[model samples]
Target: MTLSTQERTGPGDQAATGVVAIEATRLEKSFGNAAVLRGLDMKVRDGEVVAIFGANGAGKTTLLRILATLTRPDHGTVSIYGNDLAREAERARLSLGAVLHSPMLYGDMTVEENLKFFGRMFRVPGLSARVLEIADRMGLTPRLDQRVRELSHGYRKRAALARALLHRPRVLLLDEAETGLDEPARQVLDSVIAEHRAAGHAVVMTTHSVERGIAASDRVLVLAGGRFALDEPSSSVTLTDVTRFYIEPEPGDA
Candidate 1:
């Protein structure tokens, strides 16, 4: 129930046939009369990457936010790394790394200062060394002393990503992470995702770009009408298929 208790039991207690990194069942959310998420169910296994594609207002960000623990669902339950999110929020957070639209950084803080601050918060071991390592990996070593507000959007995003990875979280939740990144920066992001997968972590991301989504994901999920319209292996789907689904209505649409 409590975070400490959940952590004491550890994720190993729940590990079975396949290690499930994220699980959400009967998820629902609404803002006043408008329903955003409707009875969604999802499961992401360790070492897997799942990309969610949806048109605007299709609840893509909303789902990612819920997984990030930024918002609570109106109904249903979520688990992260086998910890019940509702009951073990703190423990669940320890397994999550998120790169949302906003970087969630202190604009006035230097890049190094921001990473140091988050590293301390996450209680990352070898804080100083970890900061340098992540900064270099993210191509932020040169900009370490630059104030976050002074950095370009791409650099700031890299910083945010570094912060997210500071503690080596096992579940990655990326909400439009590649929105403004250039080719190199995007490549860096792709590399990071690959590394995470190689290390047996799980990634769930939302993207509008069909190419990037398909390229980066092992599985593809199309969210339409507040529910999953398509769930299939990325290797079995094509960009044209995704585009057609987005351009046209679902088969039963009136």
Candidate 2:
């Protein structure tokens, strides 16, 4: 379903929970002879946070990549804030913020440079203020001047996150964002997610940390056999349930 002109302007009040920010229908992706996604359907509403949980090679990353517009689906349709991915890729990208497995940063560029560069690309208002604010929020202020390659994994991850959030995108996509984060960084991540949802933005993230994922999300989904084996509200599922569902193969899984 396409969004109306008024709805396509930008994120609205947090009360507009019915608005769909990210929609993917009949998504199918295959690499060589192996199909990674099979007719998958997903819809994330504004002011919502959805966490995707799955085993290794369960197509989690592939799904996120497709949503982030970093990888194209062989056959499918993706719409971000009413913009069709294939027909309006450039427009669609304006509303999306993604942090994938790769840091997507220039190793030689300092953390501050990376953020400012992306800020300019997004045309963020008050670029200087935004950069400092995001750096502080992500705890990268001190390391902002340090080259990306000079920082450790945790710091680099923080820099990437800062870059993604600098634009204040309407749709946020993260792939294993918590992988290299420390306790403080994780806390910052949680705060960022909360603020994004509060602003009526949508977030779709893939994580192996089940408990943390459930805790930080409004809904949880388990992907298996290139499809969602289980989908439910976070309030209705427990860690044990998710673990069991991930381990137990579905009818045609193997």
Scored by Cα lDDT, where does model 1 land?
0.83
TM-score of 2: 0.90
lDDT of 1 by residue, 143-214 (tens): 999999999999999999998999999999999999899999999999999888778788899998889888
lDDT of 2 by residue, 146-185 (tens): 9999999999889989989888888889899989888988
lDDT of 2: 0.83
lDDT of each: 0.83, 0.83
Deviation (Å) of 123 in candidate 2: 1.9
Q: lDDT of model 1 at residue 97?
A: 95
RMSD of each: 6.9, 5.0
